[model samples]
Target: MNEQEFLASYDPRAYPAVAVTVDVVALTIREGALHLLLIRRGEPPFAGHWALPGGFVRPDEDLITGARRELAEETGLGGERLHRIHLEQLGSYGDPDRDPRMRIVSVAHLAFAPDLPDAAAGSDADEAGWLPVTALPGRQLAFDHARVIDDGVERARSKLEYTPLATRFLAPEFTITELRAVYETVWGQPLHAGNFHRKVLSVPGFVESTGASTERGGARGGPRAKLYRAGDARLLHPALLRPAREEAVR
Candidate 1:
């Protein structure tokens, strides 16, 4: 072996770099309820515990690619369906002792979808599924996943008023009523229909009409509603905020 070749065979552990991984907080509106995607850890440290879908990053993969790959592994969907997915980094979780195995850093991502099927573990996951956000299991999470999920939820809730993100939870063409429900579900508050309608339409670029209408009205008596799709604006001006409650004075 030549000197050049011998030097390249050094131990990787001698100069170890932190391992990076990507986790996903896949949120969806299911059964008029908000849900999150989670996987059951199969390995030790946190074995059998439910956590967010995630995996270590490969040498050549980018952060977003790793997230989509993890999502596809947890759930059997990919490509444009995944590319069209609205994904953004929620934050990073790297509390020294978060991972029991080794020093690992995780980039948490938040994705909004109209609907999704149950996830079955693939790649490094043991099992995956959609769980109602309100009823997250009590089992201990793998890493700092519980905290990561909390951040993702708050990001979703806060972004609703000033961004067009809420629309990501709806189909391409949806009625104003359908859009309002998305807000109500995420905020967990009931909004006046008249006020909601006026505010939503007033925000330019929040939505634009497709010049189409739903033939079938709501479950009960209601007029046919017009169909609209997402507009050009990424942020909403004059954001539609919910009313604040006043504290009772003694």
Candidate 2:
């Protein structure tokens, strides 16, 4: 058919309507616990319910751009802070009835940042803050957000096993003890200190020594601990599997 005939025959409204959105599952460790960033919804469908920071994707923006834009809008994190955050596509969630208003599909993104400041609510959110993941069980999360948070948490837990992503949740330089705490907190279990230390050091390029020690002694008054920074390894050779995984399987 000719171009003019094809154009005239097509009907834009023939197909079912659908909308796309982006949601960010921003996770961080605060006070030795795992926390997820959330915003209180200000609009109906589920107004007042806490949810992952997100919004409808703008026609002019791509998925990742939309995700970052929604994050910045809800958290007020921009420039250096925003650029420093590690973001990745988590998954796409679009259960037929997930959205009450319409057939909406959301592309969720996962983010990790060193302890961040409180979030500032945007135009569509009533308030924004980081809430402990442990406290999410009984909470009323808007839409299918609770499931989204679960997926993000599982991704974080699994990534820490084979990737150096745990460092993304820590300061530039940290002690081995502090690094171990990141694992323990995210895994929601205790790790043997001696075993963890040995395994970490054995993983070449996992961390590098700075030839410096903390000015103060240990919290209980031992010799000063050595300081180290993230190394160049993209993946852990001998992945540090969570100790509780076997138990959970059983």
Candidate 3:
């Protein structure tokens, strides 16, 4: 058959109708703790519950594009701010009964960045703001969002071990101490300061000295720590595995 004949014969209704949505798990460090952007739903099927910023995928846009759009609309992030976020697809979830109204396959995305501005609620949301992850257990999240948030946090934690993406959670120039804080915050544990500093410097291409130091001395009035910027290496030659994970594996 020709192209037109095949198109005419295709039956979209031959299978059960399914919807595709995009949810963003945007993470950042705020006040020395991990925070996530959440919006309170203003519509049905999970109305009035705090959830990740997301919504139905429009007909014309692609998956990643749709995810960005949802964040733009639901969280009121501008185009430039949205572009600064490091967004990547985490996975897709499509359990038969995941969504009460119908079958919905959510293409979940994970984003990380340096602390962002406060979120503003858009039309679909009653409220929006950054909530510390430690408080997630207290809030009633909608639409399997609790699970999604967990998965996204895990992804960020794991990536810190091997990828230099952790730098994305900081300014262009930062101190090793500041960088280590990012790992410590996301991993939910304190990393040894001396050990972390030595390992970071030893890692080839993990960071490069900027020939400068911080303006102020250490907290106790010690000498200023040297500054460094992200290096060229894409992967950490020797991954900085989580210490707890190491003990668990042993």
Candidate 4:
């Protein structure tokens, strides 16, 4: 058959229908705890239920763009406000019955941001806010969002072992104490301050000393803490391993 003839005969309806969506597991450290951005549905299919910020993607929109748009919409945050947040594709969920309506595949994204201001709900959400991940176990979640959040949390924990992404949850300049807190918060375990400081300093591109100290001293009224900024290295050569994982290998 000629190419033009084949094109003319093509019918998209011949096959089963499928839709694509983008769900973001946005994470941030607030008050020494890891929080996730959740929105309460104002419409059906899960009315009044809490879920990650996301929606069906526009036909012409890219995955990452759709993820960002949905996040901005549901959280009522502007693009500039979300610019510093690191967003990456976590994984794709496509179970046959994952969505009650048709076969919809969701590409989930994991985002890391600093402590942002309070959020206002968007059109599809009745309410929007950051909720601690630890507090979600008792709350009812919609769709496969529970598993998605689990994967997102694990992804963040594992990345901290090899990447400098934890710093994404901090300001432009921070003390090692603050950096350690981010790790401990995401990993849900205490990291030895001395060991963590040493490892961070030894890494080639982990951080660069800013040569400035905080204006205030420690809680105990000690010397001001030194400040450092994230460095040029994209990957840490000697990856920082969690204390338990570090011990298990030895």
Candidate that scores best on lDDT: 2
Error of 1 at 224 (Å): 0.7
The better-scoring model by lDDT among 2 and 4 is 2
lDDT of 4 by residue, 1-250 (tens): 9999999999999999999999999998888899999988898888999999999999889999899898787656775777667989999999999889899999999999896667778888898999999999987899999999999999999999999998898999999999999999999988889988999999998999899999999999999999999999899889999888998988
Tell me the tens digit of each residue's lDDT in model 1 across 25-76: 9999999889899988887778888888888899999999999988888878
Candidate 2 TM-score to native: 0.93
lDDT of 3 by residue, 119-199 (tens): 889887889999999999999999888899999999999999998988999999999999999999999999999999999
**What's the residue-level lDDT of 81 in candidate 3?**
76
Q: Give the local distance difference test score of model 1.
A: 0.86
- The Cα RMSD in angstroms, rounded to one decimal, for candidate 1 relative to the true structure is 4.2
Better of 3 and 4 by lDDT: 4
Higher-ranked by lDDT: 1 or 3: 3
Clashes (N, CA, C under 3 Å) per candidate: 0, 0, 0, 0
Choose 1 or 4, whichever is better by TM-score.
4
Q: Could you tell me how far off, in angstroms, the CA of residue 111 lies in candidate 3 after the best superposition?
A: 0.4
Clashing pairs in 2: none
RMSD of each: 4.2, 2.1, 1.5, 1.3
- Model 2 C-alpha lDDT per residue in residues 1-250, reported as the tens digit of each score: 9999999999989999999999999999999899889988898979989999898999999998898898888677888788889999999999989998899999999999986878899888888898999999867899999889989999999999999999999899999999999999999999999999999999999999999999999879999999999999999998898876645755
Question: Against the unseen true structure, what C-alpha lDDT does each candidate score?
Answer: 0.86, 0.91, 0.90, 0.91
Pairs clashing in candidate 3?
Answer: none
| Candidate 3 Cα errors over 4 Å, as ranges | 248-250
